[model samples]
Target: MENRHAPDSLDSIYSIDSLRARHQQLAAQEPRLRIRERALRLGVPEAALVAAGCGVHARPLAGTAQALFRELGTLGPLMALSRNDAAVHERHGRYLDIQADGPVGLVLGPDIDLRLFFNSWKHFYAVSENGRHSLQFFDRSGEAVHKVYRTEHTDGAAWDAYVERFATEAGLPVVAEPPGAPEQAEAPDDAGALRSHWLGLTDTHDFFAMLRHFKVSRLGALRAAGADLAQPVAGDAVEAMLGAAAASGLPIMCFVANRGIVQIHTGPVKRLLRTGPWFNVLDDTFNLHLNTEAVASSWVVNKPTSDGWVTSLELYGADGELIVQFFGERKPGKPELPAWRSLMASLCAQPLAA
Candidate 1:
């Protein structure tokens, strides 16, 4: 992707040829920056930068997002990646058992699991550079939502065939405008009523609807849910939790997302390495790189489910965006692990003051 040959000049920079040239220049100069970051620095949509190189190593992909995603299984073992500004999740495995209904989709496979929201999915492209390959999807605003990449376990021929079949002509995608500022709803006065509904919840999935009914933000609802339901904990507790989990051979579920898709890692995380701001899990099949500096708050939330009370470690960004979350590994019918509960109890023994 670096220095794909420069244009005659930097003139007409937004033009397709110029955009391609400038993109490659920065890619070579700033090799550490992702395409999304490079595009943002260029003051244009990342999808547009991709569209500009349509006839080269980039190919615009067509068909419904679900349809294209279904073809991934045939290409053999690969890598699935999803990220936001602060976290990057990469899982390696074959894409299997993908199901979609209406605007939502789920990939339930032992190796690569994901919860996808199709409504936010827009542009798709098959990109290859220096033998590296990936099918990248972007939201309507050109922000990346998800990506499937060719891995060492992948058959190169199979990957090439899949891309060839789905490939379409190159042209800049028509993207949606970014949304306006969110209107903050006044905090509901019925904290007690909301707490009642929250406490009586039969499933954690219902918590979202409960919040909607109360017209309260998630952080706000947490504040009103009382200390028993939610409580601020030491932000540094993540390290302690992970270290303990690793030591005890405890399997956990890790979730990282942006607006379009949620990528999950289920099982045990083995190797831990810290590089600068990133706290990473560098397991063979699953890798998580989290920019811990972005964390502004951390909360221990206990939600009542029919099986039992489920607890999770929720970290938030400075702008109130969810950075990442953690929970003891579990299935629908299973109760929260007693071990996990005990671990969390120890972590939450001390809480923020009134």
Candidate 2:
């Protein structure tokens, strides 16, 4: 199988080593008691306070809940006298509120950062002080979802126990192995380290590769429509292009330049072809006939006419530079398309990108 991973270059901006070092440094600077105190001051329950500091399953809540809190919790009274603060109740508040009603999940720290791994069907809510500390609640998604809180006296031990129970009940992936007895060290695997490094770098490469996939897919779709000359085209082609675009981190609507004039060939256009000129089904904007000159410029025509119309398409950016090309008809059985499919599959494994 082709290796479809994001680029390793992203590590420079979001490096695991750097993140780990920062987390450790911050942990060292702030005492456990202080962290617990801050959490409590924000009206967090004792359980949450313990979990945030030293619990095995301690994880940052994500999705709509996080976005909602980031937009509103800070502007409220929750952070009136705390150290940590969030900016809420801004113009963007409505957007966050809408998303909060959608599907979302939490992501843990550096160990599992960027991973959209969720433990349960839960929503995390928050209440902030006057720009100080923030209190968060994790609950089920419902109109009457109950709120749970953590207190100041909540210690690491209590948090750890709760995490263990939660993980056991939910069957979620464990973030780390349980702490061993004092003076004992966990064995390191040299092979595992090497594998991890390669995999991590591959993820970075895949990120950029997705952009290429989008370019190729768009070219293919347009070519299948005969350079917009063919009035109607298969919906499957559009679907394929949109799917590829999504994998590349682009919006679905971005592919459509003009909606009202767009002619979608719902099925096989080849079957509907006649020995005549191409006609526009809508607006009659352009001739239905294919322009041999434009086709020659965009594609290389070398194959026999009896094999059906096949052309190579080269894509250019706004600066008139070549991005990628789609050669010939896009056969569903072709192996070349797998590279794009693999890239998409890896992206799917990630919690839909933030």
Candidate 3:
């Protein structure tokens, strides 16, 4: 069911040109196969596959991240997509209020909310298939950072202008070295100091700095601070959380992030569907696919904000990676919703799954 060819072995047999030709042939017949999965099977980066189909199927884009993002707003209606290995998040809207400073960028809009880190974003392309066009960006590892696809309401004239402005010569994408293993951070021995900083946190943005100072992972920090600051919750609480949110019509926020980008969904989710190891939220404008099996631990973390005490449900993977997060939908100058907070408290009281 899966291709088992090693990268080196495939390289020894097929030249780059032949591989590209073969990819095209396969792609034509198996249009449903996702390019990312196809690339993994071929032992190549996903961007490489898309790049191999340049000229006829795709075009290269050349420019700085800031310059390119600023132009995206002109594209009118588009679909923004971001996904990790276990989950995918997609939103259909316009990219607005784009601000880029140094290596970071933010899309602060009612729809299409994203926080982007551009340091690893090195390759860009405009891909066309089956009459659909999308601007795709990738990190050094050839992993997708973000993608924007033109919708029926999108401005065709603006799309053409953007393509004409950034088009480049057709060629294969440049590959980067594989990502190195993350540095092992040992937890601080001073539990009191760690708890002091944790309890003193006034903003969620400061959480990362606290982790850096304690030299610990998020779960480690939660453990060091004990149950009062960060309480251990049953992993199955996610299902209950989603169900309650849908039943009560409670507006909430869901955050999913990869290495180079984080995507957010606000408002309410109505549909909750499950299939095997996957749990899905299939709404009209939003879709979330989460692998429940990959979640190793879940915690309910609270932080003091100017508005009040904000709470969150954070899920972690086996390797200490943050998988996804959930919170009550709230904006600046507003506190979290009372209904959502009540639901979390009730869910937290439930016994752990055996």
Candidate 4:
């Protein structure tokens, strides 16, 4: 199947026509003092100022200053403009307008507000309704960048200070520093805290303890019952045996013998010691095929010795049948038999009426 996921396209929403219109509007509205200050700072002729009420100057540097004027002028107007175009929404208000001639750009905002702009070469300005801030972001070639704003008041300073601290703790670079802010202290190591959190989330100790107990208890019972046959019976037989065991309130573990060709259900009981890879004396294996529908089944258990070890055997037979079932737990291992074996033997040797 073909993959259905694909990303959308990237395109600018602010067009050249919109930028040129805003540029003209700002050029007409510049103040004389503002133009003179900007011209002096940029080493440009005052007569060339667009907002100075002098019109475009004829001086040799007039072209350069006018270029700078247009560049700086675009910033204020662009910041005030808004658009609800589809391309504008695609960027969520962040889109770049690439111009063929001068370096003019426009950035949109979430409210469709024109948020920022840049010009051909000199000066970078940002506008907000509260006020406007100007900074020299570039030289004649637009190379150098500088910080445009900083807070001097108590609240702004404190907020900036906290931001710096947060950045340090988060392992990120601090971009802005507050006035009179103290040097950042090294963040403390969190390795131990992280490890503790992981332990709290996992709580592996209790889980492992339960698992180990289950393994040990089940293995011990299987060994006592002598149901160590390495075969597995059909899925249905195992389910039947498990159901019967559950109904009887007996603790038992069932395992497959002969790699699932047969199953052996083993448990411990006081009488009728039994073990099995349960099979009839003549059949060689308990024939599950004989009674395909019989749901009731039986398994034999043996008594425990004085030493607490049970010599258990299991025999699975069709319910209400006299035929001999399978035998298990025939021999002892490296350990010698304890009194518990005798008790189990006595119990196993008892007679039952089939």
Q: Pick the candidate with the highest TM-score.
A: 1
Model 3 residue-pair collision total: 0
Q: 237-336, model 2: which lDDT tens digit per residue?
A: 3224334443453311110001001111111111112233221111111112221122222322111122232222232333222222333223333322
Q: lDDT for each of the candidates?
A: 0.81, 0.26, 0.80, 0.26
- Supply candidate 1's per-residue lDDT for 176: 39
Q: What CA RMSD would candidate 2 show? A: 22.2
TM-score of 3: 0.89
Candidate 3 residues 1-354, lDDT tens each? Answer: 122323555453245687677677767777668888777666677777777772238788888767888889888888898988778888888899998767989998898899999888878888897788999888877778888988899999999899889989964444644665554354667889998887787677898898887777777787777665677788799999999889988999999998889999999999999999999999988889899999888888777766777788888888778889999999878987878777667656532111
Residue range with the least summed lDDT across 10 consecutive positions in model 2: 82-91
Stretches > 4 Å off in candidate 4: 1-32, 35-105, 110-112, 115-119, 124-354
Question: If the candidates were sorted by their lDDT against the true structure, best first, what order would they fall in?
Answer: 1, 3, 2, 4
Question: Model 3 segments beyond 4 Å from truth?
Answer: 1-15, 21-32, 54-56, 180-186, 349-354
Model 1 Cα lDDT, one tens digit per residue, 1-354: 122223334345457776777777888788888666887777676677777762237788888788888778888899999998899999999888988755899999999898989987889999876677889898877777998898888988988888888888853444434744443344557989988888889898898788788877778888788888888889788888888898898999999988889999999888988999999989999999988899998889888888988999998888777889999999999998888887777778654221
Model 3 alpha-carbon miss at residue 77, Å: 1.2
| Native-structure RMSD, model 4 | 34.8
Backbone clash count for every predicted candidate, in the order shown: 0, 37, 0, 28
The ten-residue window of minimal lDDT in model 4 covers 82-91
